[model samples]
Each structure stands twice: as structure tokens, then as C-alpha cells.
Target: MAKLVERRPLKAWERLNILAFLKGMRTTLRWLLKRPITLEYPEARPYIPDNYRGTPTLVKDIYGREKCVACQLCEHICPAKAIRITPGPAPEGFSHIGRAPAIFQIDRSRCIHCGLCEEVCPEEAIVLQKEYSFSGTDRNAMMIDKEELYEAGGTLPDKYFKWGKSE
Candidate 1:
């Protein structure tokens, strides 16, 4: 029977070179010389882009009606299932069974902040606010319901996109 030999571990000098600290120190020095990329983020707000997509806000018409047609197109378009909608009653005094969302909620915790919902809305019922700071103390506080979303939603001005027209 032949005896098997175990190989010894390589010495530190013989080991492959990896710059873990040197590169980090270099980056730190560069950053120290340059202006900070961020300030007191939570306290100090920063400027936002015109097409910035932060949180989903629900829109309503001047006629006191929700802009959402309850088409479920936004729900279908969302990559993250952050939006929750339940069917609601039709327009009052009208026999036609039109659709409305009984419960329209957006879970900020699960949202990716993608603008797909805004893009897919036929009636332009949903939009992302210029406001980016979404910090909250409670878990439920982050979950914006219909009323809260509506309140957060600023005026529906004409949207201007650099790439294309704001639909």
C-alpha cells in the first residue's frame, strides 16, 4: 500500500495579491479631498429631477372622482406586487357597473420605485411624486392607503418628460 501525502498551505508571500485595504485607503483619501456626495441625508433634503419617481400617489379629478378607472392595468404592469386594489361600487345613480378600487394601497417596503404603473395608467390616475424622503417610524406608516396617497399627491400639472411626452 502506498502512503498519501498532504500538501502544505501556501506562505503569505507566495499567496495571490489582493488589495483589500490599500484600494480602500486610496478611495478614502480621494473622497476626503473631494466634496461629500451626501449630507445629513435624513435631515437635509436634496434636489429631485423633473421625472423623478419616488412614491406612488393616487390622483383624482376636479369632479371629485378618482382618476383611476379601476382598469387594473397598473396592477398588471407592476413588476413588484406592491400595489393592492379591491373592487368598489360604480358611479352613483348610474345602473352601469363601473369599476372602482375599494382599497388602493401601496406598500413602500416592497416597492422598487419603477414608473411602470404611471406609464400603464390610461386615465393617468397614478404618479410618482418629486418627494423622495419616505422615512417613517412605524412599519404601517410606510404603507400608504388611498386617502394618504391622495393627500400626498400634489396637483396634477402637465407632466414634462425629456425623452417623451408625459402620458
Candidate 2:
């Protein structure tokens, strides 16, 4: 057998929702007095995860030779038209197989960070790096050239794991 339960009727003041509004205001005020979680930039750098794709960089072969064949695949595949490469034959005494780029430039302003250029690179020359803190006074300064790319890419300890590859 079940016991009979008595139900209490809501008062007019309770039905007005004043109590609910006061509870919400109390929660908001409590949060307002808390410290901010934001860090001071320039003095502090944010943590970057391993899979972060910040900047597109060029990589070198194990022998310190430029891995790019100057094939222009990355340039053609870039949807933003940010990549530009001037192809030229390798020097007479060079052991490299493919033509080298006379002028390779990446306009950071136009790059969309889609990683399409890195995906299409047959030689695996281009890779998305973990560097995001970048600033320039002028547009031309943001346009990264071959030398800068080489410097940034060469120092990387590991090559970017190709996307869609089985571990």
C-alpha cells in the first residue's frame, strides 16, 4: 500500500519568478569578482599543441639539401595564390635531380592556412609549423622569402607527419 502525499500550492510571490531572478543575479555577481584567465602577451607565450598548424615552412632533406624540386605543385595548388615560385635548372655541379626555384615567396597576408599547399607537395617540402607569433610593420615584411623558410624549416626536429597517413 502507498502512503498519501500532500502537495503544497505555489504562493503568488513564488509564481512571480523573483526568487529565480535573484539566484541568477547572485551567480553573476560571484563570477564578476573572480580573477581573469587571460595572460599578458609579449611577456608570455601561449602553449602550442603538436598538431598545431601556424605557419607554412619549407623543409630540407637529411643531407641538408633543399627538399623542394621546384615543381610548382604547391604554388598551383594554393587557393589563396599566396605561393610564388620561379623555376630554374640546377647549377652544373649540383647533385640535385630537379630544377631549383630561383625565387620562392609566400605572401602571408594572402595565405588562408588551409594546408592545401602542404598536402599537394610531392617532395614533402612544405609543412605547416607550430609558430604563430608573427608581426610585421609592412606588407612586404610579412611576405616570407626562401631564406627565412629554409631557416625555420631546417631547424625543425621532426618532419610534419603527412595528413591521412596510417600511424
Candidate 3:
């Protein structure tokens, strides 16, 4: 069985709805007197924290040599399957390292920017940089190749070098 509910008649003031309108206007007027907190973009970028993860890029050592040894750890650990690497024999001068990436590419559209690639890299070559405003008109333009990654990452000072001369 359904329960019956009593219906009540509206008062004259409630039917006019003037109180609701006045309440809404009061809220609008209160906010209109305050200053806006809008940020002027392009000229002013928001503050990014030290631990902020933006995009993955390849870095070189302080000596201007590539730090990645083509370990493929970053590619294997990537959840988005955005990273691709083709391993090749290390250059003649880089005898200490066994292999290097003949070709390395990352599809920006597929990347989730989870920082897993950075965390899995043994040589710390791949890192999440503070560059978040990457845009491209086409799919090909969005793919980050090895050269481009290195150019964006620049070089990072390292305390240990596998190919460093003995003291």
C-alpha cells in the first residue's frame, strides 16, 4: 500500500517568488563588489613545484654525451606503450657501454605522463621535465624523437661517469 501525503496551499508572498529573486540578487551584488582572481595567461605562468611531472625527455651527461644505454627499461615499464626504441651497438668511442638506441621515439598523444618511464630508467637518462605546454598541429609533429628529446632536456651534471678516465 502507498502512503498518502498532505498537500499544503502556498501563501501569497511565496507565490510571488520575490524573496527568492531578492536572495539571488543579493548574492550577485555581494560578489560584484569583490575583485576578480583571474590570471593573465601567456604573460604569467603558474608556479610549478619541484616534484611536478610534465613530460618525458631524454637527457645527456655533463660531458655532452648521451646517457641512455638502450636498456629498454623505460619502454618495457611504460603503461601507455608510447615509447619505442631500436637498440644498436654502441659507437666505437663508447666502449664501456654495450648498446645504444639507434632510434628512440615517444608518441606524445599516447603518453600519460605518469613518470613511470623516468622512475624505471637505470641511467636516469629519461626524466620528466617541467615543460607542459607542448602542442602540435599534426600527429607526426607531436612525436618526440631522440634528437628532439635531447635538445629539450639539454644536459644534466653527473657525479659518476662509466667512461670517465681513471684517476
Candidate 4:
């Protein structure tokens, strides 16, 4: 059996909700007096830390040559399967590396920015840059090819040329 509960009637002031309105106004006034923490985007990009994992890009050696030997380690390790590589014989003077990627592509839409590709690369050819803001009109626009990756990565100084004779 359910027990019957007695209900108390609201007072005149409570029915009018005057206290509730004043409480809401107090909250609004408190917030209005505080300085805003919002940042104006586009005009003011937030600071990106040194260890920020953003875009994945293929870097070049100090000599402006592609550092990737086309081992396909990045492709194999990518959890999202965003990387694709096709190996070919190394270009003319780059015979020291034996092979290079004839075709390399990264689909930004599929990439999770996990930095696994960067970590798995034996040559450190793949790097996760501090470029978090990127947009594309369509899927094809988001697909970054080998040349675009090289351009975005620019050049990272190599302490030693593993493929060349040590000075």
C-alpha cells in the first residue's frame, strides 16, 4: 500500500517567483562584471606548445633531399590507415638510400593525429608539425601528396647523413 504524503502550499512571494528572479539577476551581474576569457580566433591563434601533435608531414634533409627511404613503416603503423606509399628506385644522385617513395599520400580526414607514424619512422622523415588549423572544401582538397608534405615540412637539419659517408 502507498502512503499518502501531505503537501505544503507555496507562499504568495514564492508563487510570484521574485526570489528566483533576483537569484538569476545576481548570477548574470556576477558574470557581467568578470573579464571574458574568450579569445578572438583567426586574428588571435592560441599558443601551440612544442610537443603539440598536429599535422603529419614528410620532412627533407639539410641537403633538401627527401629523407624517407620508402620503408612504408608509417603506413603500416597508422591506426587510421591514413598513409599510403609506393616505393621506387631512388633518384639519380640519391642512390645511397636505395629506394624512395614514388607516391606518398596522407588523407587528413582519416588521420587521428596520434603521432604513431612520426614515432615509427626509422629515419625521422615523418614529423608531426604544429599546424593544427587546416580546412578543405572537399575530400580531395584534404589529401596531401608527397610534394605538399615536403613543402609543409620544409627542411630539418640532419646531424649526420646516415646514407652518406660520415665527415
The true-versus-predicted C-alpha distance at residue 123 of model 1, in Å, is 0.8
The candidate scoring highest on TM-score is 4
Worst 10-residue stretch by lDDT in candidate 1? 158-167
Ranking by TM-score: 4, 3, 2, 1
In model 3, the runs with Cα more than 4 Å from the true position are: 1-36, 159-167
Steric overlap count per candidate:
0, 0, 0, 0
CA lDDT of 1 in candidate 2? 100
User: Per-residue lDDT of 1-167 in model 2, one digit per residue for the tens?
Assistant: 99998989999998999999999999989988998667898698778897688889998766666667799999999999999999877655556455777789999988878999888987778888887778889999889999999887774333443433222
Q: Which regions of candidate 4 are displaced past 4 Å?
A: 4-9, 157-167
lDDT of each: 0.76, 0.81, 0.86, 0.89
Quote model 2's TM-score: 0.70
On a 0 to 100 scale, what is the lDDT of residue 141 in model 1?
A: 79
Using all chains and alpha carbons, the TM-scores for the candidates as numbered come to 0.64, 0.70, 0.74, 0.80
Is 1 or 3 the stronger prediction by lDDT?
Answer: 3
In the range 1-167, model 4's lDDT, one tens digit per residue, is 99999999999999999999999999999999999767899798888998899999988887788889999999999999999999998989985688999999999999999999988888888999999888999999999999999999988765434445331
Residue 56 CA error for candidate 3 (Å)? 0.2
TM-score of 3: 0.74
lDDT at 59 for candidate 1? 70
Tens-place lDDT per residue, model 1, 1-167, is 99999999977855744465677889899999998788796687788887889888987654455666577888878899888888787667534337777888888987898999998887777888777767778878778888888888744744422233333
Clash pairs, candidate 4, are none
lDDT of 4 at 2: 100
